[model samples]
Target: MKVVHVDYRINEKINVNQFYDLLVNSTLGERRPVDDVECLAGMLLNSNLTVSAWVEGKLVGLARSMTDFNYACYLSDLAVNRIYQNRGIGKQLQILTQAQLNKRCKLILISAPTANGYYDKIGFTNNPRCWVLERDSDISI
Candidate 1:
């Protein structure tokens, strides 16, 4: 399948609604309404570091990072359509997002139980030096 990779350069330029729609329709794990995705997209778009993927004007994937543009970054919401999996689109999204970060920045992402291997294949690894403090066992509120 042919894919179009794009880096959105301006805030408010992408349709947040479409972004949410694609994520929801793709059954990429969680389901989000248009407004929820819109809010998330709005925040990411205003952020200095953000990236997205499209296939002929259709939003198929998205990833965003919060960074100092130098030291460290937290990558969030990396998602690709179920139909588009295994086509290297996920890797391309990561590469595109990484290109916008500073070389000194350490990237981090929380992988789903089944998706860890995929991220590992793309050069993301578990940090031996990091620790997570859990305040609650219930993830769902």
Candidate 2:
């Protein structure tokens, strides 16, 4: 399959009704509502940190990251359609995102709780320098 990696600006024009559907079909059992895809896509678009893959004009894979453009980046979602799995689409998405990030940024990602091994194979090692704290999303700003 011929694949291309382009920035999320393309998402705006994609036939994403199915794109959203495929993401919701993730076998990892994470089924997000379509509304969540719309909201997340909007936020990522505005942040200038989303990239996606296309095959024959169809949205086949996607990944998004938040970056300071200088020092830090957090990769949020990395996905490839079920039909396209094992075809190297996911790796291509990561390569594209990393190429955009380069050496100037510290990259971090939280893999699906069950799919931790895949991320490790791609050169991500555990880092002790970071700690995460959770706050309710509804908490006051």
Model 1, 1-141: lDDT tens digits are 655454333122456666666567654437344456556667556655657666667766777667786887777567777777777777877877777778877778777667878878998877666566676766775
Tens-digit lDDT track of model 2 for 49-125: 65677666676677667788578878767777777777776777777777777587877777665667777877788
**Pairs clashing in candidate 2?**
none
TM-score of every model versus the real structure: 0.72, 0.72
Give the per-residue Cα lDDT of candidate 1 at 30.
Answer: 73
For residue 133, give model 2's deviation from the true position in Å.
4.9
Candidate 2's C-alpha lDDT?
0.65
Backbone clashes per model, in order? 0, 0
Candidate 2 stretches with Cα past 4 Å from truth are 1-19, 28-38, 128-141
Alpha-carbon shift of residue 3 in model 1 (angstroms):
7.5
Estimate the TM-score for candidate 1. Answer: 0.72
For each candidate, the alpha-carbon lDDT, in order, equals 0.67, 0.65
In candidate 1, stretches whose alpha carbon ends up further than 4 angstroms from where it belongs are 1-12, 26-42, 128-141
